[model samples]
Target: MLAFERLGIRFGGNQAVQDVTGSLTPGKITAIIGPNGAGKTTFFNMLSGFYKPTSGVITLSGQPISGRPTHEVVARGVARTFQTTTLYKNLSALENAVLGHRVRTKAGLLDALLRSGRERHDESESLKAAHHALERVGLERKAHVTASLLSQEEQKRVSIASALATQPSILLLDEPAGGLNPEETARLMDLIRQLVGAGLTVALIEHKMNLVMGLADQVMVLHHGQLIAQGPPAEVSRNPAVITAYLGSHGGGGQHGQSAPAGGASV
Candidate 1:
């Protein structure tokens, strides 16, 4: 449901992403993998409207979405969670999740001041949605707790719930497993699989190779701001370029046609 065509981004004279092209279909997860400084996050920023692309087009379901304001992108059925967990520390978990719903309304000052039945109904619905989102991420019991009281993994789940609360058609996740333990990472992968199975399009930039290989339906490898390979995990793992760039130093052993387990592990 998300497609990029000849995408390029530059900062002054330096290009961080160049001629990138890919497609992520609905009900599927696409993983973007690359070594450090490969412009993976830069591509995500451009896609999320955080940075306008220097050249190219980003389309969602056939409509161009690139260069739109960030809020406008959210309004157009796109929502993303950052690599860092960004919850209001003092706020209750429920309150933090409900913030995602604020972008879904069309209320004005008068509506807030008057507190009409419509506003009340919307508010109630927002709470219900937020609660459901929290439950989806397995954080329902912590709804009334302060965001700061949770652990790092819990905070990441809260971030995902907040994004889901926005009801976006496409969810872009940046390194959702960055700081989690192995067990937590496995659970997160299961959650991601469940999300895509339920009809949401997910595109993620992740370094946790185990989760990516196990959960991603398609893999796109970027190196030096260009796509070096794109294919199934089995094929991408065996790709000469991908091995040399990210895996060669870590037990790749110059074997290009054998299965390689992710997460710096061997199969």
Candidate 2:
């Protein structure tokens, strides 16, 4: 399990996340939901090692990992996707995915310069891994395509392929359904479920309550950097504090087709 103990972060005098504690079980999908400025992405940043928490500890299967560098975290079996797609636009999808295996490669600069046997071996392994990752995300056919030329949904899948190439135990996704149409969103949802079914732990920060309610095994509600409620979706959805914090007067009722509020905090 991935666990956070009283995790908190402060930006100057402003507290972005405070005393937030939670555990994400392996092989399950956990959804993080909240309104603008609710610190949803801030929490994700800390988990992915992009931000070092000002206080508290984070542990994965009993090993402390808080404040580790991002690459180190990836090496430790955690990989993530951002709200904004991060890809090498000029690179082919397969090449971009191959880059994700950098942390696991042992070939040195000297090996590359000399074109040694080890370099060749590692390169071959990386290519195979990249192809498998793309296949997992249903993007194998687009492997040779330039990232910039793919549709938004395809770009998102490429990003996911890159993360999968790392062979992570935990996958953190931020706003994956952000700009997707309903059909695309449904496909993405099915993909996520398939991943979880294949024994991966997924934690997503999503604005779409419909996706959250339908897909998550556990739901965590954040409000102004604090965890206001957490439980199964049915339970969290009915919590009055959670409703006031983000669900609004609809009480999460009409959230099926609605988007999140404008200018929501990113991190």
Candidate 3:
């Protein structure tokens, strides 16, 4: 479980994120939705330790984790995948995932140089972990392939597999469906559901309203750096504030260039 209480962040004189508060339950998917510049990414960066929040606290499993270093936060059972794919083009998919397990390796410098018993054991364990992570993401067949040679969708999966290789209790995904086709998006939804079914908590920020509506158990809407709405999909869809926030910017009463079914409800 996680909680953000009255979270606030300012970039110079601009208050990018203003007093936002929410919580994420274990074994559930929570979606943070809003138009561009809603401060969703800023909230994520603060939670992930990329930026220290100007105010409030972020607690993971009841312990405050605000202002911790990114690496330290990751070691504390949190992992993240960016909007854009981040992988080693020269490395094989398996190698990239193995790198995620780097923090867990016990092989010392001398052991690595000499290929000692400990080094060999660590290597074998890391390999098995990497393979297992890839398998979880349906990328096992691409394990030995070079990352640069894979398609965009495949590359995205590899990025997720790498994050999973870290064995996180909570995963934060930014725009997982950003560039995927319909089929790919469906597959991604299935993967996310599977992860939640397996008891992993997921906090996702997605522009793809369809995916969010179909997958999120709880939806939180942010507008102008503030919490505009928070509830189940059905209630959120009927909210006037949400409609205005989505539709007002565009010419129509509640139509933002595209129609996003209310509440991140099922598509």
Candidate 4:
């Protein structure tokens, strides 16, 4: 399990995340939901090693990994995708996927310069892994296509494929459904479930209540950098604190200027 205890971070005088604690169980999907500025992304950044928490501890299978470098985190079975697609537009999908295997590569500068047997073996392994990742996402047919030519949904899949290539036990996805149409979103949802079924732990930060409610095994609600509610989807949706946080005093009413879906009180 990936666990957080009082995990928090401060930027200068601003406390971006504070006193948040949670655990992502293995082989399950955990969704983090909150309004803008609620510090959901901040919390994710801390987990991915983009930012170090000012106070708290993070552990993977009981081993502390709070302030480690990003590469180290990846090496320790944690890999993540961003809110925005981060692929090289000019690169083929296969090439982009191969980059994710960097942490597993053992070839040194000498191996590269001399074209040693180890370098060739690593290259062959990376190519095989990349193709497998693309196949996992149903994108193996598009391996040779440049990223820029793919549709938004396809690009998102490529990003996911890249992360999968890293062979992580824990996957962190930031807004994986951000710009997809309903059909695409549904497909992505199925893909997430399949990954969890295969024993990969998934922790996602999402604003779409429908996806969170439908896909998550557990839901965590954040407000103003603090954890406001956590439980199974049905229970968390009915929590008065969660309702108030999302809809303000108009709890059962409209979205209250929030971009969340209408009747999002159901979480």
* Per-model TM against the reference: 0.91, 0.92, 0.91, 0.95
By the TM-score metric, which is better: model 2 or model 3? 2
- Estimate the lDDT of model 3: 0.86
Clashing residue pairs in candidate 4 are: none
Task: Please provide, for model 3 over 134-206, each residue's C-alpha lDDT reduced to its tens digit, 9 standing for 90 to 100.
Answer: 9999999999999999988889889999888888899999998888988999999999999888879999998
For each candidate in the order shown, give its overall lDDT on alpha carbons.
Answer: 0.86, 0.89, 0.86, 0.89
Residue 23 shift from truth in candidate 3, angstroms:
0.9
lDDT of 2 by residue, 1-267 (tens): 889999999999999999999899899999998877889899999999999999999998899999999998999999999999999999999999999987778899999999999999999999999999999999999999999999999999999999999999999999999899889999999999999999999999997777887889998888889999999988887777775665356655433333333232222
- Candidate 4 residue lDDT tens string, 1-267: 889999999999998899998899789999998777899989999998889899999998899999999999998899999999999999999999999987789999999899999999999999999999999999999999999999999999999999999999999999999999779999999999988998899999988788888899998888899999998988887787776777777654635466432244223
User: After TM-score superposition, what is the CA distance of residue 210 in candidate 3 from its true location, in Å?
Assistant: 1.2
Q: What is the Cα-based lDDT of residue 157 in candidate 1?
A: 90
Off by over 4 Å in 2: 247-267
- For candidate 1, write residues 168-229 as lDDT tens digits: 88999999998899999988988888887877899999877778778888899888899989
**lDDT of residue 102 for candidate 3:** 69
Q: Model 4, which residues run further than 4 Å from truth? A: 250-256, 259-267
State which candidate, 1 or 2, has the greater lDDT.
Answer: 2
Q: Name the lDDT value of residue 70 in candidate 4.
A: 93
